[model samples]
Target: MIEQTKCNAILQKEAESFRNTSRRTFIKRLAGGTAVIAAAPYISCGKAGDSFEALKESAGALSTGNIGDEAFWREVKKQFIIDKKLIVMNAANLSPSPVPVMEILFELTRDVDRDASSQNRSKFSTLRQQTREAVAAYIGADPEEVAIVRNTSEGNNMVINGLSLNKGDEVVIWDQNHPTLNVAWDVRAERYGFTVKKVGTPLKPQTAEDLVEPFRDAITNRTKVLAFSDISNITGVRLPENELCAMARDAGIITVIDGAQSIGAMNLNMHDIGCDFYTCSSHKWMMGPREAGILYVKKEHITDLYPSIVGVGWEGAIGSGTARKFETLGQQANERIAAFGKTVEFLDAIGKDRIEARILSIAAALRDGISKRVPGVEFYNPQNREMSGGIVKFASPEIDLSDAGSTLYETYGIVCSVHGGNFPGIRLSTHIYNTMEEIEKATEAAAGLV
Candidate 1:
């Protein structure tokens, strides 16, 4: 039971007090607040009938101050333990758990292990609902519209395979898509004889419209779906998902977005972005427990998307029916899922807007340092700070950039990908824990190639 009475009573009271509180006034109050976190451009959670813009603004980082203000993010950083010898630059792949979420995960898991059916039955169900509600609210979505999946691949697969399109339907993807997503669409296209048309989306994109224009140009009368990544793990260029989704909607195309990199790193307003489907890997930017993922399907599209995994409760009514139509049958890791709630709690506590700002700011600083310090650096991320994401990949042909493994292993002790492909370079990812000092050292180390 959710204690609906108490929650309703609180909302009612908050609503009565806010009878005249306008969004503008609330925002102004946020800007003037004396509390350190509340003083940021978008921190405070204001009013009831809650929408995400208040929260989204809270997710933005401090644009005007020192990065990682100790009084600010040290507590946030205390939530995680870093590998002593390795600086994690592979957040695009995964993230370490925060202490709060880790503790919840460990405890909940033990409880579930002790007794699966009786103890965890309602508890697991409650976690799913809360997780869905938190994520939905994060993106301004209806809680009933979200589904908890395992990863972006699984979430995307639900929409890819769930779409009512038949053989010969056209779908669009880009060269820069993560393999997990690319392969899922490919599998569907191959199985159903649908045409999968993928085009070039460059690393240093010309413009959001220009980058998306390729996908638009590939569309024909047969084009039914436009699928793409919000940011490429390979290139780290953030895509204009909303603008492109609107473009596709104008063409009567269904949109599905691979948000593994975008979800926790950027300000994601799925409603504003207008995608029919958005999927994320929680372990990445969210630092949620491993194997936890989130999927959002437009409410109208729910009944239409047949569940990818069927179980005892799946085949019932699809739209609002448990949303578990996506759930896998058999036992699940109860502890890890419980920990997922703590991750949301932690993010909520710090505020999403601040997190978003902090990440982009840190990334932009690194981008600037790399661009200025390393002449050998081939800049691939977007020039504008807004388009920049947490990932910044650079390559160099000069000197022995060949020592990537030893360079990270022995010298700087940074653990990053070679970004390993044509035009290969180092990928130094920075999160809230990463300080300006560390960034300077990392850039100075990379500048060594010259």
Candidate 2:
């Protein structure tokens, strides 16, 4: 590990570099001389300020090769305000925002509360655009193709309601998709007289083709849309999204990907995936503020899809001929939107590929540790990292699911998702915030339940 003083110096240097780059980008965006002067305070201070300096510093201190070093990750974990007593492994459902993101959120919220005047709030417009651009660049999409919506549900519905489906048209989806992408389609199909088919994959997939073939067989001549999750939140199955999207595209079908699980946990490029539409929530794996999400609409389909909400600024948004039309929901929480950009910056500083590798490592460790210690353990998720991401779902026949979940929390201070009914197991979705030591303790706790 680098010395503390030297690390601090490196962090400060990186932070200054980030600030300079941001200033240049902001100034370039506002090319008008008077507009730059008017936006100077917003640029130099609150909007493009030091909100993410701590995050950048922490990430910059670590060498690229030190991604697997526990010491370096421990420093990264310190950037979050999670309770010291609790081990949070539920990044699929939600994640605690890091200190930098929360700082920006609180700072902006206080600013809004202090002065609700239009003049004071004008800076948010520019900040929102910056966030849109950041999200676009992060996911490898054009700025005009990204919309800052409320959450995955809203993004899902935007495409669900936006598409022009008719009777005899079929939409093929995975059975494991979240309700927003699953039931939402059924609800829409009921009204429109369209068909919604749910396809299921093998319980234990051996290869990527095992997952892709099922969806391939489900599509037919009448299939107009192919909707599925990049990673199933329940079973932790990572689908062959690029192949699936390419298949749908070749068949002249629109592909809608619910990226609730994969967006932050994995490194993704929307263009490479070749999906017509993609949706994700920031609060889950991105660790941004709640109720903030992103909607990606392919530029060619921008005019084809209708806007779900037509509130204030609908005319200009429509006239813009971009994905902005999908974000016309009025009276948004501007503070949360601004903080979402900070969350992106935090992830970018750490590097998405490194975060993905760390997440997969912890997941594999937890899975291996549990399977070795606990007898007759059943894993719902795939063991191979190629077919999985950060999620690991398992249950022992001897222990009740609810009791195991409660005991894991109450006795071990480990918080994970518990499922009942059809899938009775505990789901542990780890992230960069988690440590190997915590996974070992959790493994012991699971064994004790037996």
Among these predictions, the greatest lDDT belongs to 2
RMSD of each: 10.7, 6.9
What is candidate 1's lDDT per residue for 103-174, written digit by digit as tens?
455434544454455633455665566667777787778887777777787787777777877787888887
Weakest lDDT window of 10 consecutive positions for candidate 1: 42-51
RMSD of candidate 2 to the true fold? 6.9
lDDT of each: 0.68, 0.83
What lDDT tens digits, residue by residue, belong to model 2 across residues 250-332? 99999999999998889999999899999999999999999999999999999999887899998899999999988889898
